[model samples]
Target: MTHSEMITVLSQRLRWPEEKVSELLSVATEVIGDQLSEPGTLSLPGLGNFTSRKSKEFISLHPETGERYLIPPSIDLFFRVAPALKKQFEEREEE
Candidate 1:
């Protein structure tokens, strides 16, 4: 779901104010972003993980020009959702 939709649902379920829900959503996303930008592991219990991979620099040819250039190593983050969340979706789908 989109961020605003999540905020609306959270506000109703938790009986929190809309403004507070918005703040909470913002903080959660900000924290996740900050953590992923670094080279480290983010392990959430019951959830899976967010890890950064260092891709080595390499030279690649440009498809059109056939020219090669040094490509910088980049950090990539991957997420694996919890099995419980997958099961929840499965059960919902069965309905």
Candidate 2:
């Protein structure tokens, strides 16, 4: 869902104001980004783990032009879903 939609849902569920929910989400993302930049993992109990890693530089070929180029190394972020959450999704799909 969109950011506004998520804020609306969170405000209703937490009995918080929309503005407050929005601020919370903003701070949360900032914190997550900061942690990821540190190359650390952030774990949420029922959600999963978020981690970041640096990938090595690689060479790439342009198929159409047959030109070769060097791709710079970069940091990649990834999320792994919690086992319980995965099971819940699997059950829903089976229904």
Best by lDDT: 2
Residue 16 in model 1: shift from native, Å?
Answer: 1.3
Model 1 Cα lDDT, one tens digit per residue, 1-95: 98788888999999999899898778988998888888888988777888887778999999999999999999988888878877777788542
Model 2 lDDT per residue over 8-87, tens place? 99999999999999998899899888888877688998899998998899999999999999999988999999998998
Stretches of candidate 2 above 4 Å error? 63-66, 90-95
**What TM-score does structure 1 among the candidates reach?**
0.75
Worst 10 residues of 1 by lDDT: 86-95
Q: How many steric clashes does model 1 contain?
A: 0
Note the Cα lDDT for every prediction shown: 0.86, 0.90
